[model samples]
Target: MLKKNTQHEKVSHRKPVVLMSMGAQERKGHDYQVMTVKYIKPLAEHAGCVPLLAPTCCGSEDIEQYLSMVDGVYLTGAGSNIDPALYGQENLTPDKQQDPNRDNFDIPLIHAALKMGLPIFAICRGMQELNVALGGDLHQKLYAEPNMLDHREDGDESVDEQYADAHQVRLVSNSWLSKLLEAEEIPVNSLHGQSIKTLGAGVQVLAHAEDGAIEAIHLPEVEQFTLGVQWHPEWKAAQNPNSIKIFAAFGDACRLQVQARS
Candidate 1:
């Protein structure tokens, strides 16, 4: 009988590669595409995945190529807002920062990624982008709306305080998100001036704030894990059970994609 060398035998398990969309920034006479460390850390720590940054400074002509190499897509919150023109709306907040380059790249990227059945987790501005890509419009100034609560964080507060839990969001009964988190309501940080005014096609509301602002959404049409949240769950995700579960779920879906491809 031959003795099996179990110690020397190696089994390989590939980590899912998530294509993280970058925001365009210009500084010191140079143009740069960047994503915050806050968003990146959670994917590496909680999600158990590799992060691949996709540049939006350059147009998304090569989006298909970028998608081909990754198992999932992660759209993160950005300092800039999406261009209103994409969703048939005139420039309502022209003074606010808008990234047309990112707009051009992410919209097509969203459509193509969906076509390829990639799991997507979008946050803040990314959520707005997803809504616009799906034919939805934003309030532009959510605080200005009648009876709407102001969702923006005070600029004077420290970063940690700004990202702290600001309000509670009521999760829809029998929602996938509610089931995953095992909670009917969860406290979330609020730091945006705009909110979804009109829902996009196939977009289903998952959670809402006390003021009725849409806090989270999901696409029921996509069999893969597709979720968009207005809050910044990536901020100190390890400290929060809800954030950990959300990222872990996304990571699991990406791993399944990796398995399918293999």
Candidate 2:
């Protein structure tokens, strides 16, 4: 038997764990919490992190605990729209889908995550949640707003077609996204009806669509990585260089958090 050379082998570093907020859904008669594989794949493959789905159907009391268990937070897009009342507006789109349990849980979770300085990557509806959580408002019906382009995905299109590049978003000069993508502008997919109407207290615009809708944002004041995009970067992320950059940056930030805790 050979003796183990433990002295020469370095201890392996653990991958960062990301707490991902999930959507509330109903299948048949029972209500359930769900998270799509699309969101999980990039976090695991590109970000090199363990994906932990946090159920928003549950109460928000565990947000602090959830924060303690992970190095980063991921807020994924959902099929439902946020309740307009959150930003002090009446429910103008009452006919649109809404998930009250998810709304109640995720808002407090975003607050808690920010308070802890945890890196957050919010997408689509997740971006809206982050905005509302920070005192910003959204255009309940973006297309309805004069001069704004329709950003919603075509309902009858296949998944791949819907996630295909819809338009170009001009990156803010010298912003983090522009630096990462190494370009002034890039093509992006669009699949949302609401968009930022007012900038959040500390949220800085990172990119914009041709029609002037906010395409990307980040907290310039935050030390940790904080980003939100109106597009679904997680869709076919491995195949997109821009999406790869976004996930890679987020992964690096998460790993740094792991090192800090160690």
Model 2 C-alpha lDDT per residue in residues 1-262, reported as the tens digit of each score: 1334452232126789999988778889998889999999999999999998888766888889989999999999999999989998998788988998889998999888888989999999999899999999999999999999999999999989999999999999988689899999999998999999998799889999999999899988878899999999999999999899999999999988887886
Number of backbone-clashing residue pairs for each candidate, in the order shown:
0, 0
RMSD of each: 2.7, 2.7
TM-score quality measure for candidate 2: 0.95
Off by over 4 Å in 1: 1-12
- RMSD of candidate 1 to the truth, in angstroms, is 2.7
Q: Which pairs of residues collide in model 1?
A: none
N/CA/C clash count, model 1 = 0
lDDT for position 130 in model 2: 91
Looking at model 2, the pairs that clash are none
Query: What local lDDT does model 1 show for residue 183?
Result: 97
* Residue 100 lDDT, candidate 2, scale 0-100: 89
lDDT (Cα) of model 2 = 0.90
45, model 2: CA deviation in Å?
Answer: 0.3
**Position 222, candidate 2: lDDT:** 79
